[model samples]
Target: MTQRLLSFGLGYSARALARRLLAQGWTIHGTTRDAEKAEALAREGVQPLLWGQDDIEPILAQSTHILISAGPDEAGDPVLNAHGALIREHAVRLRWAGYLSTTGVYGDHAGGWVDEETPLAPSTRRGQLRQEAEAAWQAVPGLPLHIFRLAGIYGPGRGPFAKVRRGTARRIIKPGQVFSRIHVEDIAQVLAASIAQPDPGAVYNLCDDDPAPPEEVIAYAAELLGLPVPPAVDFDAAEMTPMARSFYAESKRVRNDRIKRDLGVALVYPDYRAGLDALAQDEAGE
Candidate 1:
């Protein structure tokens, strides 16, 4: 049987995984809201179906794997709200299911370390929705669900280098405010590992080995770009939108032990510095 994966939303990380699996001969299909994005995905050889513009039941029936990268809204998870019953009915066809959640679900660990077993205490609305979505997905009977709580995701085009180059980077100094992050490629690897080793109802925190201050990452990116590092701005003094400010409210070091131990996975870029350096190399190569 040809391996087929149907992703709810094939955004950055999901598309990366799709590219990887596509090389290995897996058929890919996903949903997107925008017509332009759907066309782009089609160009990349991914079967793109517009949400509400097409029926997903047949795709769901044929999928051997399913990945939900769509975040929940005020009402609830968009995917669950739209297709929860269908997923439950097609559970037998799905060899594996994954929910891409955020480490923000474990809010404000006071710069302390948190693992998969850590209790969820989300301080932000986004985190709350993710936690609720995770629970809702787990409740779907017979779904081979694997939950991945990802940290701040950064990669080639999405890294701090772009901000530094564009002169929009800010070195916000918030004492004791540290954040865990992961390279998007590593996220794809972790997802692939989980698919290979099917574990139903398993939760894993996906982050790099290092948890450092955001300012340090910005500074590192500047150094790599051979540009002057942005001046420091105190968190309280920095002018930021409510959503950006909310990001600074949480301080925690996320651990990826479960992925390492259970999946036998090794991260390519284990810290921001390494990740930045790799991105720089890729830029230079390009």
Candidate 2:
């Protein structure tokens, strides 16, 4: 039987996974709010449907696996808010469901380590929203839910190279601050592993082994590009957007043993060094 996946939000990470599945002969149907992107996805071999413009029930019924990457607003999860009842009613062929969440739900751990078993104490509103979204999805009766609390996602076009190239890179130094990040490829791999294993109600932390300071990552990108490393700016003194400032409020090293222990996923890029090296190589090639 051909595997069919319905990606509720065909954004960056979802597109990465969709490309992999498409290569392996799986049929992919993705929903996007943008018309041009829908056309672009269609050209790239994914069947695209517009949000609110197209009926999601037929797609939900046909999907063997469902992945929700759409974020929640103040109103709540757009996918759940719009199609919770329809999903419970029409997901007849669905064997697996995955929710792409964030490790921010763990909030600030004072630069301490947190595993999957750690209780959530979100420090930010965004984190609190994710916590709420996780519960909302888990509450859906008959829905096979797997929540992946992803770390700082960095890969390909979304890496530090762009900021460095634009001369907008800043090394914000915060004492004892460390962050866990994962390559987009690893995120896809972990999701695929979970889909293959099919464990409902499982929660996995998707992150790399090494958790380092944000300044170090920026410096490494500069070294790879042979550019002058951006000067360090103290976090307290740095002029930043409210969103960027909010990100700096949390400091925690996330653990990724569950994905390995449960799904047997071997991460492709285990550290920022390996991930950055690959990105640098790709940049050189381009």
Candidate 3:
């Protein structure tokens, strides 16, 4: 049987996974809100379906796997709100279902470690929504749900090199504030591995082995670009949007042992240095 995947939101991370699956002859149907992005997806060989504008029921029926990257709103997960019933009806046919969640759902661990077994106690509204969304998806009976709690995602055009080159990168300093992050390509491989070995109701934390302070990452990026390290600014004194400030509200080192031990997945970029190196090399090559 031909494998078909229907992705709720074909954003950066999901698109990376779609690229891999598409190369393997998998049919990819992804949803996007923008017409231009729909054209972009089509250019990448993804069948683009506009959310809320296109009928997804038929697509859902034929999908052997589904990936939900759509974020939750105040009410709840948008996908579940609109197609929870449809997904429930077609649950039995789905070979695998993946939900992209965040490590924030584990809440602040005071720079401590949190694994998949950690009890969820989200500190922010965004984290709370993701936790609730995870529960809502797990509530759907017979759904082969797999939850991936991703740490900070960085790769390709999303890295800090741009800011470093533009001379606007700031080394935001908050005492003991450390974060775990994953390369986009690493996320893709983990998802592909999980698909190869389906484990329903499984939860995995997607992050690198190294969890370092935010300032250190900025400094490294500057060094990679051969630019002077950005000036350090105290977190309290720095002027930032509420959304950016909210990120500093939590500090945790998310564990990614499950993805390695369970799926036998090896991350291509194991740490920020390696990831940044590859990104720099890619940029240089381009």
Give candidate 3's whole-model lDDT.
Answer: 0.96
State the C-alpha lDDT per candidate: 0.93, 0.93, 0.96
lDDT of 1 by residue, 79-98 (tens): 98999889989986689999
The prediction achieving the highest TM-score against the true structure is 3
Task: Note the residue pairs that clash in candidate 1.
Answer: none
Cα RMSD for candidates in order: 0.8, 0.9, 0.6
Candidate 3 or 1, higher lDDT: 3
What tens-digit string does per-residue lDDT give for candidate 2 at 90-176? 654579999999999998998999999999999999999999999999888878889999999999889898898889999999999
Model 3 alpha-carbon miss at residue 277, Å? 0.2
By lDDT, rank the candidates, best first: 3, 1, 2
Model 3, TM vs. native:
0.99
Off by over 4 Å in 2: 91-93
Name the candidate that leads on lDDT. 3
* Model 3 regions lying over 4 Å from their true place: none
lDDT of 2: 0.93
